[model samples]
Target: MAEWVPVFRGEELPPGLMRVVTIGDQRILVANVEGTFYAIGAVCTHTEGYLDEGYIEDRTVVCPIHFSRFSLISGEVVEGPAEEPEPTYPVEVRNGIVYVQR
Candidate 1:
């Protein structure tokens, strides 16, 4: 029953940036890495830190609370206080817009 939802214009998020978006009740974290877009659960696995408030380093997002690092593309925990990997969603771009499948 899932479908792709348009979240933002592709140009709104530049490389090395992230944003938090709400799609019908689900909160998601979106990132841009060198032009490719990625989507993941918005909350950090360890302490529920808002990932949109996190810092970007290389391809990783560092949680602002406990400094946990997660891969922007895979949502794998790169460095932690977090042992669980974040839930990653499929992302696509079409007609100069970015969409996420939930």
Candidate 2:
């Protein structure tokens, strides 16, 4: 089974905000959508642009490079130049902290 590592506290992330964190060699983007947390791959599939630098619009994360948009909740490539969906990590909330399964 994968281990869940603490990424950030729920209070640290407000709604419509994102934080990029690296656990070991894995880079993940943690987003807060109205007190709910979602974790997704930090790198864009197209050119490895940082998704954290991208804008969040209505639950979709748009890549700054080629304007590829991905669903933050589902990791689906809603629009692309990106042919593959970004990987999503499982998130758990405990004691107002956010942990990600990696």
Candidate 3:
């Protein structure tokens, strides 16, 4: 089983905000939508845009490079220059902390 790494305190990331956490060699973008947390690969599939620099529109993350939009919840390409979908990570909240599967 993949390990679950603590990424954020539940209160640290409020609704409509995002942060990047590095686990091993992987960079993951963690987003907060309403009160739920979602995680995905931090690099944009299209042009290597750092997704942590992107903005969130609802549950969608807009890529900073070419505006390739990705769904934060599903890691699917919502709109693209990015033909490939990002990898989604399982996220959980326990004892007021947010954990992401690595």
The per-model lDDT (C-alpha) reads: 0.91, 0.91, 0.93
Per-residue CA lDDT of candidate 1, range 5-102, in tens? Answer: 99899999999888998988888999988898888889999999998898888888899999999988788999988999998999999999899998
Model 1: runs farther than 4 Å from truth? none
TM-score of each: 0.94, 0.96, 0.96
Top model by lDDT, which number?
3
Question: Model 1: what TM-score?
Answer: 0.94
Tens digits of per-residue lDDT, candidate 3, 1-102, equal 799999779999889899999999999999999988999999999999999898999789999989999999889999978999999999999999999998
Whole-structure CA lDDT of model 1: 0.91
Question: What are the runs in model 3 whose C-alpha is more than 4 Å off?
Answer: none
lDDT for 64 (candidate 3): 91
